[model samples]
Target: MGTLPVAKKKKAGRQKCSSKPVKLPDDASAEELARLARAVAHPARVRILRLLTDRETCICGEIVAELPLAQSTVSQHLKILKESGMIQGEI
Candidate 1:
């Protein structure tokens, strides 16, 4: 009997995300503004934004190294920022 190929299982926990900026329709800006505001609402997110602004680019590991939070925490923050179009990267 031929063995069936097992489908690869996705790892649990924070999944990888692309930080590429997502463009929205012109009319969508107002709706997105609130989300963007919330994304930067946290101090940690603010610091992350500043770090990216100062450096112009950063890897997820680099951001995590600079912050006191755990890697998972940083990843979550990055995800929010990326989703809001505040920052872009592969994380």
Candidate 2:
């Protein structure tokens, strides 16, 4: 079966996200805001975070069982969320 390829990021210009809830500090960089917004943009990533947030822990293999995506793909997604500080794990 062919896996649905992840969409390439759109190279739109640095459009100001006026809808941002809280105004960021002056010291925050554009790249930092963009990265944070991107991390919470996916449904799968949101689900993973929600699961961990409630349970307080989960292994990579368990996530794979709950998601349609492959284990490696789920791990990659988890890594991104973890790196972005939206989630944490035992390991």
Candidate 3:
């Protein structure tokens, strides 16, 4: 009998977006800053946004195909961008 490899489960814990929706310095809400930080945290995400910003339109699936990352990872990155108001999802 052949052995099958086991798949690891991913972590899906809750994260607090901000302490409160209080006014921020420079009119940048804490949430917005956090979101921007998340977007710029990863090099891949930077690349992803750069591609989308320069292209007429970018398909999420195409990004996964272009980058040497797992499809799910790329999707996560896309989700971050969408949440950050930096990009939109077409499908």
Candidate 4:
């Protein structure tokens, strides 16, 4: 019997968004736009936002399950989202 080779998991590095920034209307404050931009700067956070919007609610464990991240990492992402006013919840 041939043995299957196990693939090594690569360590995740910081990812940068390659898309150009959209010009917002003059009414929006630069600080507000920066805050919101920081909130979604990570792919994981974006995924979490999508997951929450899809169901209206979710626990930290649920979000962790959907992403390939650790519980602590997910919690950190959630914290950034909350601080940026992107999301709100006890978890």
**Deviating ranges (above 4 Å) for candidate 2:** 1-30, 89-91
Instruction: Compute each candidate's TM-score over C-alphas.
Output: 0.64, 0.58, 0.60, 0.67
Write down the lDDT that model 1 would get.
0.61
How would you encode candidate 2's per-residue C-alpha lDDT over 1-91 as one tens digit per residue?
A: 1111121112331111111123345787888788877987999987865555444234556557888998767767866865654544321
Candidates sorted by lDDT, best first: 1, 4, 3, 2
Candidate 4 stretches with Cα past 4 Å from truth are 1-27
lDDT of 2 at 89: 37
lDDT per residue, candidate 4, 1-79, as tens digits?
1111111122342221111223345787989899889989999888876676565234566667789999889878877
lDDT of 1 at 6: 16
lDDT per residue (tens digit) for residues 1-91 in model 3: 1111111122332111111122225878788788678777999988875555455434455567778998779778766755665554222
lDDT of each: 0.61, 0.54, 0.54, 0.59
Clashes of 4: 0
Residue clash pairs of candidate 1 = none
Largest lDDT belongs to which candidate?
Answer: 1
Candidate number that wins on TM-score, 3 or 4:
4
Q: Which ten contiguous residues of candidate 4 have the minimum total lDDT?
A: 1-10
lDDT of 1 at 5: 16
Deviation (Å) of 11 in candidate 2: 40
